[model samples]
Target: MLKRLLPVSLLVSLTALGLAQPGGLTQTLLPYTLQLNPEQFEQQGLALAQEAAQLAQFDQIELALPRAQLAVQLAPQSAKVWSLLGSLYLQKNDLDQGITALQKARLLDPKSASVLFALGSAYFQKAKYTQAVDYLQAGLKLKPNIPGALFDLGNAYYMQKRFQEAIAQYEKAIKQDANFWPAINNIGLIHYEQGEIDAAIRQWRTAISLDAKAAEPQLALAVALYTKGDREQGLALGEAALKLDSRYADLKFLKENLWGERLLKDTKRFIATPRIQASLVRTPQPLLPRTAP
Candidate 1:
């Protein structure tokens, strides 16, 4: 669930306003000067693309999609428009469309690291690990210090069961961005998967310390602590994690997020506790009767 952070709206808003001017020329009053008009359609398309990017940043995928699509239509040659559209499609969970859009962007701007990174991420989502590796490596070659790219390359490696390679990439990501809690949390996941429970716990603890409000690390540490007989604190952490993000409380959501089997089982048991059940606002459905054997 790595995502781009939403930036303050003021900058993008001003940029959009500037680009949205139909004439593509701004008259200057101070010096009594005027500039020649630029390409009007391209400017408008770029503005729409920027608007879509900002909306997507704020998790307004539904609203962003139309604007992104319109930008692509208006400026088919613009690499930025296609890249934004691809990212919007990915956020909207339309992997096929995302792949198409990102591929188009790559074709238009073969040297763009952002486009390569987006395509790699899209391939990862679609379970095309080899393609993910290729594109991610290509992106890293162009922009070696991009922590997001490094983090995702780690994930691609992890999925392929290349544990040491995954750890190396995660470590590189941490070096580039010390506060990147996701990479730290994912390193914990690898440790847990390898039966290095104590190491995993340590990584999770570090992740929680770095980002107190992060739900994933909190939930993971809770599960680890509960299994180690630290019941009270573990339960509290679990509740806090759920409070931070209710989606973590959903069974199906946990599976989709790639929770390990053991973690998922423990989480199910933890959530079934009377205290946790009482705190949940959603009611459980009635169970069907078992048929006679």
Candidate 2:
């Protein structure tokens, strides 16, 4: 008899729940309207967002963008949907759109550490260091001990030439995750900029030890070694670095990697060396002389 009554009771309960109106005391307990269920939209949006992420992983931006956009429309008030859209924009290299989506996500969920960090990272990529600092600091305050955030904060400070502050942040990152080679490598960059050659070399060596496959620290250490007259060892290290990533041999690539003015100048000199030039698979292009008309 109880089993026979179960279906009717369940149906009655669902009907009563569906009658929940929007905006009032009853709305507080059951937020969705009778016709339009907000929870269903959120669930559908989440599924679409997941599909978008999977498509993006395969570099199917054409398909991913439509799904991401649809998710946002479906779950207009969902902070997670907005954040996913923001990340998709970032992945597509649409910095302006990425920032806008992330800002919306922040508005929807002001206390979201993930949203704040995403905003900070997007700003950093945009070269808006001041704004990056503000957002990153806010995120850190909410959830400390994130190594990537600390590293990026250090990078923003480094770009502004706030060496001490940058070093402090990098150190904090290293403390949280000793295997974080980028922070160690960046600390080396600061030392090199300050003309602390031996210290810079030590830091680079440490970074290389932490992540031997990383090209940046290896190339940096090579440049420093060559500058110090250790030609053979430096050339070998440069060759190894180039093997890891041929792009690192490009001057334009180095410039984009946040090498400081002094460091870049020194790197230019180091790259000019015949041995170092020979080690690189992609040789530097020479300027052609112009003929007068």
Best by TM-score: 2
Output candidate 1 Cα RMSD.
11.5
lDDT (tens digit, per residue) of candidate 2 on 1-293: 11111233333333443532234434465333234466765676788888998998887888888778877866789898899899889877799999899999999999999999999988988889999999999999999999999998999999999999999999999999999988988999999999999999999999999888988899899988988999889888987887777666666777677777777877788777787677663544335322110
Model 2: lDDT equals 0.81
**Candidate 2: misplaced stretches above 4 Å?**
1-38, 282-293
In model 1, where do residues sit more than 4 Å from their true spots? 1-38, 58-60, 281-293
Backbone clashes per model, in order? 0, 0
Worst 10 residues of 2 by lDDT: 1-10
Q: lDDT of each prediction vs. the true structure?
A: 0.80, 0.81
lDDT for model 1 comes to 0.80
**Candidate 1, run of 10 with poorest lDDT:** 2-11
